[model samples]
Target: MSQPEFDTYATSPRTLTVEDLQVSVGDHLVAVNGVSFQIRRGEAVGLVGESGSGKTLTCRAVLGLLPETGEVDAGTITLGEGATAVDLTGAARPTWDRVRGARIGAVFQDPGSYLNPSISVGRQLVEQLRVRGGLGRTEARERAVELFGEVGLHDPAGVFHHYPHQLSGGMLQRVLIAIAVACDPELLIADEATTALDAVIQAEILELIARLRRDHELSLLLVTHDLAVVAETCDRILVMYGGEIVESGPTEQVLTDPRHPYTRALLSVATIGDWSRRTLEVIPGQPPAAGAQMPGCRFAPRCRYAAQACLGGQVPLTEIGTGRSARCVRLDELVTDASPIPDRIEASA
Candidate 1:
């Protein structure tokens, strides 16, 4: 059966693009290696990978949230459409300050971390409006209350006086969403946005994000390891391994008929449509520690099909089909009925 049409991640004209993005911690370990992708206005893109696969790092690079030790060593990050574009990698700090939360907004894993405990949720939101938005205090306060209501919060007026500790996880997440969408950014980076919430809250948060994107025509880059979530939320999917994109394409094609071994292995571990068994499957071996230099494919250590030729120079992204590519040396070699990429998955756990 064909996968259901996912309009949430539907394609639109490109708004943001990253090319050859290489982020590193000092001169040592490179956290994000030659990462590149594009997010079109109103389209949702999912960046899926194991923890430390550089998904978070890649998102942070755009938000200017890289740690003190980290830096964008190479590549270009362009935001905006047509002639209005800004190069994020080369732009000044003041430029990023202007872009952040205005042209580009971010919703991260922990709302608590960004929320001010000492202040009322309404007050802090007003600050964002006044500072980034340059609204007067009264106008900002009114806007904040309206935003609370917009996010489906009950009693937006009362919630305005409530502090961070007063609201439930879901409510707090809504508040964060309110702040993120306050300025109507062109691109919203949701880095593990729902990861900290409970299963039910997770669903609510994702649905809220989906609704916001739809209603506001917001572009989104959802960062998460949950294939199930990505499958439900994203139109386009990018699979990452060892700080590099292994495979990327439409959600259906990549999930059902993965081209890269890593993509297939990731699907093997994620419980998708349920080929149930007594035991669960997992990708063997951890990713290489940060900064570890490799002569060939970084995933070769964990890749089941690793051969003598696996360890060479950097594997290039090979186009398997239109707008689809995989950074696997043996993409063609593995594309056969005998390869058992999907067959094994369908047959076993």
Candidate 2:
């Protein structure tokens, strides 16, 4: 059966579309539930959530790298569009080998962990270029060095000879970026790619990613816990909570006027736009345990405005305005009121 989102987005020139994706760990724990989203060609989308919000799990599902205990129990993940679209839900290993890294690349939070400590970082990239990219050894070396320079590593030739241990954290991250984009993949999944770097270096890495996206015309799925990062780098945002996308829309609209209480709470505690200081406000409780069954909204337990009605039944994501949706029963009431959402939620709760 075709999904509404799939049918709606398939007509467009999209790079990736994940429809009704449900990921489960072990026998019964469903970590990601009914999650659906699409990334357009050259579009940068942010997947924002706290730890254990299933953001990374969702990305892993798309990458076909789920853990041994994890499996996609339901839904379809389609890459490309129309006749060329490949459904990743049941793709064989050989199909995955061709798609991952070559067609769709990924970079993680810890660059060091992903790299080989013994080998020169440049040599490692060269191996991928030769093996996956099918370039001659000499061509691979020259291309690897060129890539190093492209990612803003100073003295590209010199950096090529440095081992992972010898390079600074920032340098190693740049190497990972170079490797990820080496194949000229159409889609890039950056899972907290800048989380391990210092503030200055983090900004530099983020700038490089933005530049790469523009220069390469790559579709990006950037996963992170920070809203400010998404606000700066993403075209659209998906706010996840308790293994579901609680809210989604344009970055500016979501940041400036968040519809979901969880999103509002995130914004309150987020680092200020200037990165000068972080807001001290904190969400009252930890995120719900992954795969924990709930009767109504998963965030209701912590939401100040949660009421009996909120807990009475399921809360489906409903359209509140143009190009925006929120999974809250009281969204209509809250959005219609003239007062601020947070203020009203505070007073009501």
Top-lDDT candidate index:
2
Model 1, 1-349: lDDT tens digits are: 2323544344556778999999999666788889999887787889999998999889889888888888999999989767888888857889988999888888888898889899999998998899899999999999999999998899999999999999988898899999999988888899998888898989888888888888888888999988888888887889998899989988877887888888878877888777475577888899987788899999988887777677878899888876688988777667634355433321111
Clashing pairs in 1: 29-291
| Residue 28's lDDT in candidate 2 | 68
True-vs-predicted CA distance for residue 281, candidate 1, Å: 2.1
Candidate 1: Cα lDDT at 332: 67
Candidate 2 per-residue C-alpha lDDT over 111-161 given as tens digits, one digit per residue, 9 for 90 to 100: 999999999998999998997899999999999999999999999999999
Query: Which stretches of model 1 miss by more than 4 angstroms?
Result: 1-11, 275-278, 335-349
Model 2 residue 110 distance off true place after TM-score fit, in angstroms: 0.6
Clashes of each: 1, 0
TM-score list, all predictions: 0.92, 0.92
Off by over 4 Å in 2: 1-12, 274-279, 335-349
